[model samples]
Target: MASGNMTRQPSPPRVFVDVDVQRDFCDETGALYVKGSPNALFRRLTEHAVARGIPIVGSVDSHAWDAWEFGSNDMPAPEGGKPGFPDHCVKGTPGWLKVEGTLPPRFRFIPNVPHAPIDTAVRELATGQTHGVYFEKEVYSLFANSVAEGFLRELSAALGGAPEFVVYGVATDYCVRAAALGLVQRGYRTTLLTDAVAGITEAGVAAALGEMQAAGVALTTASAVLG
Candidate 1:
């Protein structure tokens, strides 16, 4: 039996996962803009995370100009028969960049590659050597990047356990929904900042919220999170 005086180790700080808050999705004039993106709220959330020294793990939709996912491309869809979306977030384009106030001063971009250095990433994230770590994804789901899961697993181990995740960003129906569901499926305690996200359509957002809630993702607002 353990001694009564023994103390339990403190849990790690909650992680803020910003999902695909790029200019194309947030800016009104950009391609594939999400309606009603709360740019001010996004800034506040990012600033709060940085000020509190919380780790920020985020995803960016980085596509090639001629990628199959672009509806302008003639290539066939990989799986479903559905056509692709309008060209958006093409690499090196203005719209591909992250929205203002969403990035930290000290952050690293991890490209989608077969041999990502997961160990190095975990160390940097867990030690606060990097305030934010952003993963590049070609598809709506960050999990589409093969290295993402491995990096996340190692980070969890380094942090002593799986940390609670607070998720936000553009397109509540697509990327944000995929991210929140992915986190919950991996047994992470996930929360979605409802007011901070926008969506392609009202119906989509409503359906996404229901799915997320059913999957054990807590839905709340930025104010609640900040408080």
Candidate 2:
């Protein structure tokens, strides 16, 4: 669908959020790593966001062993009982874990970090009047699927009635772009944090960025978020 901006609408408060930029997606050592994710640019973008107090949300692709995307009666499982099409982000595996030191220790430094979701990490601060909210988008856009919408609404309500969402992450052409577009359609001012994101392919990234621009989502860089 096409997107447009209406000039009369009052601008809302803005913050930075992202799709799956986890170890599984971004690190070469990870199971389902994207080729573009481990670059210095992505590190820089993530580092910059950590330095600022901007509320950062991340979408994680978590699934059980029997999910339809991986398991079907007709298809046999790959070696080690894993799927063949992609080898990553498996539930409870090290590859499924977030990258070490990607964000500051504070973000990941909980008593029980292994089971904690991103929402829990930011919930206390986000609930406070001055803090920005955080949420997770498991499937496509955080707003694309039903589960994500529940969390999105809770976060939105916490941050008052209106909020501007800036997005970044791995596989820019697909998940990241879709989430940003979804946010825009929901009447939020959306920005694409280009540098912080990586795509499966260069062409895919280029095309998605073009589509996002055409849709009236502002294209922004991590540097802009940092400074």
> All candidates' TM-scores?
0.92, 0.70
> Which regions of candidate 1 are displaced past 4 Å?
1-12
Per-model lDDT: 0.85, 0.59
Clashing residue pairs found in predicted model 2: none
Error of model 1, residue 99, in angstroms: 0.7
- What does candidate 2's lDDT look like per residue over 24-85, in tens digits? 77888776677767456545555554444344555666655554445333354443554434
The candidate maximizing TM-score is 1
Candidate 1, pairs of clashing residues: none
Instruction: State how far residue 4 of model 1 sits from its true place (Å).
Output: 34
Compare the candidates by lDDT and give the number of the best one: 1
**Residue-level lDDT tens digits of model 1 in 1-227:** 21233232236658889999899989999898888989988888887776666778999999888878777878777786745788999989999998998888778888988888777777877777777899999877878888888888888777778788889997889999999999999998999998888898889999999999999999889999787
Query: Ten-residue segment with the worst summed lDDT in candidate 1?
Result: 1-10
Report the poorest 10 consecutive residues by lDDT, candidate 2. 1-10
